[model samples]
Target: MQLCAPVGCPYFRGMASVVVEFSAQEPERLARWWADVLGWHLDTRSGTVVQPTGPGVPLRFVVSARAKARKNGVHLDLRSESHDDQNTIVERLFNAGARFADIDQSSDVPWVVMADVEGNELCVLEPRKVYADTGPVAAVVIDTSDPRSDARTMATATGMELAGERSEFASLRPPSGEGPFLEFLESESGPEGMLRVLVE
Candidate 1:
């Protein structure tokens, strides 16, 4: 596979996109929850699929017998307009069957951790300018042992541009710079997160 440059990686001019597939015991129910959360349309005519109205990734929910046993290393981060908006969103989700989750995060963190009805972890983050154009979902974060290397590899594989990098974090996005960012976070543990990822 072709590797990206350390910095200033080349863009693929929107030739690629990513689809996150979730495995759940009740696919339609889980898909409905995410569809409501994202203001997307849920189509269960065949298999469960959540389709976005505008720019965003399409999520697919597949039936699985396996249960979620631990924290998800790959999770989504929702964008908020402000502090009040963040709280409102969290409350709305709580009423919709979402529950607060603790993944060893400190109390002072700017984001609120939550899990869906099926124990799938996600975050509602404080407002930030960088995620202003990313629609409802800000980013799909993957916990990796080496953020830099994994981000670079994923960027190359997905034909996305390397957006930015720090000591313990890295980011990638489509060449058009629209939609949610794909982030890699440095973690000490091994891969024990969500199921499948489809690049198209």
Candidate 2:
């Protein structure tokens, strides 16, 4: 398929531009839950929103009556500045209604797997310098059969710069002075797991 780079494409990669979108059958409820958790702005009657912080990205919630088809192949990997911070945040998330999700993950992993109220999964990771200066929403990642091919489509469609590329993986991020990245990876095995994202 021919990829599209929208009109005014250059500016669409701005930090304040739409960075991510979530779909929900009960949009108001799910959106509100996350908004509160993230300290984002919430308007239950409309799309979920989060005011940009510094060069952070903006997020939105869209209405969708359809049930999730399967576990998401894309998910959020949240960053932490320290192990203590990671533990505290995980504890807070548990108190706020997030629960550990056993996605065939081992207990020794550096990241904790947890599911939102609606069963969407997310990870809270130990501090890594790459994300040390990024926002609470660090990166959006997905699995693909071919990172190079997928990166091309993503780059053409969103105007995000091709930040990095290698044999097994590729990443796209908003241009300099913009926001976080959107990554694509070619798994040793094909994708089949717990991660989902709504991009439309």
| Top candidate (TM-score) | 1
Estimate, for each residue in 1-200, the C-alpha lDDT of model 1 and write its tens digit. 12322211122233554777788988888999999988988877657778767657778798887888888777889999999999999999999999999998999999999999999989999999998877898988888789899888787777778889999999988877777898888988644655455565
Query: Positional deviation of 145 in candidate 2, in angstroms?
Result: 1.9
Per-residue lDDT over 1-200 for candidate 2, one digit per residue giving the tens place of the 0 to 100 score: 12222211122444223345566777678777777666656643434655454445555566666766666667777778899999998998899899998878887999999988777778898887766545676677777789888887777765567878998889877766344567787865444443333333
- Ten-residue region with minimum lDDT total, candidate 1: 1-10
Off by over 4 Å in 2: 1-18, 43-46, 187-200
Model 2 RMSD in Å is 4.1
- Whole-structure CA lDDT of model 1: 0.80
In every candidate, how many clashes are there? 0, 4
